[model samples]
Target: MDPFDSSDDSDDDIFFRMMYHYYTTDLLQPDPTSLLTRCAMLNRNREEGHKHLYRDYFADNCVYGAKDFKRRFRLSRDVFLRIANALESRYKFFQLRYDARDRREFTTLQKCAAAIRLMAMGESPDTMDDYMRMSERTARESLYTLSRGVVEAFGDVYLRKPSSHALQELYVVHEERHGFPGMIGSIYCTH
Candidate 1:
């Protein structure tokens, strides 16, 4: 991918926004300014009426378009819901698998967790975006789930770790790659 082909104007822009929180999550690398990157993707000369939300309201927080509020992009909760539902169907996601009683309440954060597990292991974002039937930003935001409410859902009370323990293997690999024991993941260790 050229990475500059925003011409399709497909709103990968919104999905890309999740890189903002993705990098910042789980003590992972910082995905702090993806919103700014998205801002830069907008073709000011080609598109009109796009009001840059992060730049306008979060000037101090964002660096890419701190001064320029010309472009606008935001992924709403509803968009995330449809994408999440679609992915659930394809993946045959059973809320029972996650130990949740009501599958209808599956939120974006839950969906994002799936995408993160999928992409972080080397799955291409393009493929994932297609599989999830949503833009890349949707993939990221669904995983991001920045709110404490969503993060809480990831805890032991809301969802049990899958018996397959794939994350456990990934944790071991993380430790092996880092030449340390801590990175494997806190779940496997007391620390």
Candidate 2:
């Protein structure tokens, strides 16, 4: 018999027919309860309610005060403000805005603080929710946007190759400190 002929009643043909019938009649049908549940879940407010953690910990005169801000954020308050200002000015995403309902959104300082903390401490975004009062998704987005803004705004000055004068200065400092006249610096590798 021809392989494509439907008249064949072989075991292989029977198995193929059974599998096709099962998939089309059972596996392909959508469950109504699952669909409704998914819609309800999406419409529900899954986000945690507003918390004052950011204000209580960072804004108030807590451990993040002027004296300890540097230790916590790995940068002085003034320096942090400067960086935040630069980022906000350069990137509209970092700028604060009001929602359509006229609700004020997160400030640039908050976003920068969250992003900087994540970068400095190498912590997961979830860790910042308690302190920053931000969702993990928001925290991650802030980290990405802030990092890109910082690189765009400051990368040229900080990441550039050393100029001749700068290199000469480095060479002189190295020579004076190590007594190696021509050696600029040393690199160490560890396994």
lDDT (C-alpha, whole model) for all candidates: 0.43, 0.72
Collision count of model 1: 12
What would the per-residue lDDT of candidate 2 be over residues 159-181, giving only the tens digit for each residue? Answer: 78999999899889977898776
- After superposing candidate 1 on the true structure, give the runs of residues whose Cα lies further than 4 Å from its correct spot: 1-120, 146-150, 154-191
Most accurate candidate by lDDT? 2
Model 1 lDDT tens row, 109-186: 334433544444555544543333444554555444433333343356436664547667766887788766554336
In model 2, what is the error at residue 37, expressed in angstroms? 8.0
Full-model lDDT, candidate 1: 0.43
Looking at candidate 2, the ten consecutive residues that score lowest on lDDT are 41-50
